[model samples]
Target: MILEIQNLHKVYNNGTHALKGVSFSVKEGEFLVVIGLSGSGKSTLLRSINRLIEPTSGTVRFLGKDITHIKGEELRKIKSQIGMVFQQFNLIKRRSVLSNVINGKLGSLGTFNSIIEKYSDEVYKEAYNCLDIVGIGDKAKVRSDSLSGGQQQRVAIARSLMQNPKLLLADEPVASLDPATSNSIMQYFERINKDFGTTVICNLHFLSLVRRYATRVIALKAGEIIYEGAPSDINEAWFKTIYGEEAEEVEIR
Candidate 1:
């Protein structure tokens, strides 16, 4: 398993129970999508994988190593193996796309060198290569904020690829894009999984987009997994089980 999340639970200091006994495993080259409403714990689940949000209980073992209890340098080193993308693009608005992409490798570089912007030629080359893979190579010199929502998300994807991670976690990656652009971005994610053997886990609000891209789907509600199965086996009834009366409120198409 690329990732093994066993009996995971997270409760915030403020007493918000984010995840409850969540358990799942992700395989190499798999494209998995998580669907849930705003407060359903999808973001928490994905962030917990990289320890951006630590679990209060349970083990998260990656490549046969338990990373849950590890801290400091050890934790940072392990987290570098996982890449994360977010809904907001999260790019430095003042920086060029290439600069933001290169920042992905900062975790692997010495602090002073990284802080001083002294990236090696190899790092720069790899950053540009990732941009090419994400179909944004031509925008390398442009400011990240100057791009459209879809293009900025692509730049963020390229930034994640620069880390050379084994697993990719995206939290509402295309939430800000239009339908057509969202489809294209999801296709790029699929291509990354198929061609690079990268494990992808994305949190999405769109059931149709999830069905179109994910091989496996996980549905969460009130911090619990209400459904877990192949995409083909999921339907409106399953959504109702997860969403209840609010099921009708969501626009899946």
Candidate 2:
């Protein structure tokens, strides 16, 4: 297993319990997708793996190591193995795409650098290679703000790839794009998972998108996982079971 989330629980300061004893395992190179409505804790689950949103309790293991117990330098070392992408591109708007992508190497770089633009040639080559993988090698010199939403998201994906991550976590990665662009971005993820054997875990609200891209689907509602199975096994009945009253509110494509 590349990622093991065991008996995880998270309770926010505002008295909202985001996760409730959720446990799951992600094998290396697997493409797993999580589906849920807004505020259903899907993002929380993904972020918890990177400790971006610390779990209130329970252990998260990455390749048999307990990351939950590791802190400070040890934790930073463990984090460098994971890469995350968000719905928002999260790129430095004023920076060139190459500059933003190079930021991925900061975790591995020593304190000798005062500025990120001074990234070593080796890291620069890696960033360029990642851009090529994402079909955006030509955009390396372009400022991030000049790119479209899909292009910007691709830059975000490239940024994650620059990290040489063992695992990729995408939180609503296509929510901001049109259907065609969303499909294109999803295809990129699928290709990356197939070609590079990068374990991919993504959160999405579109059932159709999940069916199209995910090998496995996990559904969450009210901080609880209501369904976990292959994408083909998902149906209206399963959606009803998970969404209940909200089933009518859900508009599946």
Candidate 3:
């Protein structure tokens, strides 16, 4: 397994119980999609996995090592092997696209080199290669804030790829995109997952996209896993159970 979560729980200081004893395991190279409504703890679960939110309780094991409580260098080392893409592009707006992508490897570049922005030749090559993977190599010199939403998102994916991660976590990555752009963005993720053999754990709202891309699906409701199976098995009854009786499935395409 590439990732293992055992009884993971997260209760914010505001008394918001986000994740309630969630447990699951992800195999290497599996494209797993997490589905749920707003406030279902999907974001919390992804953030907790990367220790971004700091889970209140339970354990997270990545590559056979417990990383729930590790700090400083240990945590940094583990995080370097796991890349994350968020709903927002999260790029350095004023910087060039290539610069933004190169920042992904800053964690491993040592404090002095990163502070000086003294990237090596190999790093630049890799950044361009990553951009090419996302089909945005030609936009390397353009300002990030000047690109369209979809283009900026492509830059974000390229940035994440610079980590050479074994596992990639995407929290509603295509949420802000239109239907067509969303599909295109998803295709990039699919390509990365298939060609690079990277494990993917993505949070999504559209069942159509999930069924089209995911190898396995996990439905979350109020911080709990209501269903876990192949996307094809999410029948109408199961959909209502997962999304509530009043909820109707919405297709992206």
Best by lDDT: 3
TM-score to native of every candidate shown: 0.96, 0.95, 0.98
Candidate ranking under lDDT, highest first, comes to 3, 1, 2
Q: Model 2: which residue pairs collide? A: none
Error of 1 at 37 (Å): 1.2
The worst-scoring run of ten residues by lDDT in candidate 1 lies at 244-253
* Superposition TM-score, candidate 3 onto the true structure: 0.98
Query: Model 2 Cα RMSD, Å?
Result: 1.7
> After superposition, which runs of candidate 1 have C-alpha atoms over 4 Å from their true positions?
249-253
Error of 2 at 206 (Å): 1.1
The residue pairs found clashing in candidate 3 are none
lDDT of 3 by residue, 27-145 (tens): 99999999998999999999888888789899999999999988999999888889999899899999999999998998789889888888899999999999999888999999999
TM-score, prediction 1: 0.96
Clashes of each: 0, 0, 0
> Would you list the C-alpha lDDT of every candidate in the order shown?
0.89, 0.88, 0.94
The deviation in Å at residue 93 for candidate 2 is 0.5
